[model samples]
Target: MFSDKSCVNATLISGTKETCSFFIFEAAIHWAEEGHRVIYIAPKALQSPPLTHHDRSNPSTEAFKLMRFMYLPNYETLVEQLVDLHSFASLPNVLLVDDLDNYIEDPGVKDKREVHIARLCAILLDTMNACAVILKQNVHICVSISSECEKIYQLYFDKLWKIEEEDDGNIVKVKQVAACNAANKTYEYRKYGSENIILKQILYSQN
Candidate 1:
């Protein structure tokens, strides 16, 4: 998704409370297939059964990496991991964070929800500047957040998208709600075969 820019950030919001793991997995696989290294960070590891799993057991395979948090991670710990992954001087990398709001909080301190959100945002922005922007490395940051968290996270990203399941759970709508580099866009997600999912761009009439 990133061509000219050394670093690009995007956000995805789920239209429903249900998880969007299928979409995330497809995206991760797509990036890895394109020769970019993917680092996936999740609050918990495989709490739900995935629709399909990507094979990454080969020792020589360096396409994907997964990191799960047993407990809430502090800013320092979070930054360190991101910096290390992004430190690959000549390689392209994608940092995929799933439900960041759930894993990035101070466990011991009882803080307001807003405060926790703010702190996470600060850390993410700082990491973007220090690790991605400064290094001039080809990096992509894609985060999946809930609707409530979208407002706070939107300002920090260059592109924002929303995915929702509709038509009694048969049809999926993927819309580009906000973007800095292009006009608004929308797409429909459909199944290609028994298990494959695909995206087709659709034009929406303003009327």
Candidate 2:
């Protein structure tokens, strides 16, 4: 779908919880097909999955199910999941990052925590020009990141959005805010939109 397109690179941050939660994955899937490595900045507090699974005789493994589905079983535990960094860096297409600020300002940690996380994100940002998907929980964290990466994605996200608790204390918000760039390029504000970017795919189907 993204055959003839060489315009500005725009990153869209969905605002609503439902949209923010799921839209990044869909964006990564779409962009990877076009050869962009999706570095997912996983949320600080990821929402827990619902309590529902088949009683298979085998072990109750989420990995097993993901493997069964289109997604490959990435890793077992959190530590293993960190290994995904190497996988994303080595791969030719999309990459999934659990969290960019894993140890940025973390206390009781090693000396390299800040430098390491910064280096990792810098590496991914430098590696690809297509787009990167960063998902952060809560508004403060997201705004902090957007501020930090402002220099990087100045040309990336044509639309940056926000999600917050309404006066009623429910958190379902979405708004397509306008954005400008150092290059003087302009983009339309969109609530839900997709660029022509694509991602790499499997050589063969599961079935």
Candidate 3:
């Protein structure tokens, strides 16, 4: 699902808010189930707990325990968390940030929005790189940003993914818009039952 480069592995996920949230939670669950620690950062708390494909009769408590959630309600808080990431005794295998555009478009930052956003991006990328180097391991950062802010943030990411849901609401499409080190591809997923989503097929690929 992500690269293993021993540096900053940043991915930008662009989509509607609902689609982005769904994908991020699914990805986090996937990593957690694989016995990897996952850290989820967001400006606000999730409306509901993540639902996975695991059977209700035998829930996976271990996976849930491996996940950590942080609420950084403002830009300053987010920056502080990133800057102090390396000081923590343990690091997660995957870091998920949701709705980053909200922080970048903070109401308090009324002037030089571009400059502020660029600096924030720099902090995020540089912090991740430094952590990777100090720990001697890959740092995977997945950020979900609104389409309007995609142009500003995409340049800092190694890969770009765009997601869309069909009008019927039963189908979702994920397209790899760009990748500096991987092939571009597209995939379709269909909602299964009430809460489960299953990958239907790979739509296409391009080098």
Measured by lDDT, the strongest candidate is: 3
TM-scores for all predictions: 0.68, 0.36, 0.83
What ranking emerges by TM-score with the best candidate at the front? 3, 1, 2
Q: What is the lDDT of candidate 3?
A: 0.76
Which ranges in model 1 have alpha carbons more than 4 Å from their true place? Answer: 1-6, 16-19, 47-49, 52-92, 104-109, 147-150, 179-182, 191-196, 204-207
- Which rank order by lDDT, best down to worst? 3, 1, 2
lDDT per model vs. reference: 0.56, 0.34, 0.76
Candidate 1: C-alpha RMSD to true structure equals 5.5
lDDT of 3 by residue, 7-88 (tens): 7788888887877887788778777888877888888899874333333233279988988999999887888898888777
lDDT of 1 at 182: 56
Number of clashing pairs, model 1? Answer: 0
lDDT of 2 by residue, 1-207 (tens): 121123223343534443344445444444444444344445443454211112213323332322111122221232334444334433323444332333344443455644544453444434332222221110111211321333333343344544333444222343334433322222222221232222222122121
**Which parts of model 2 have CA positions greater than 4 angstroms off?**
1-92, 96-99, 108-120, 129-159, 167-171, 180-207
lDDT by residue (54-109, candidate 1, tens digit) is 33333224444432222224545556665564455543356677666555454754
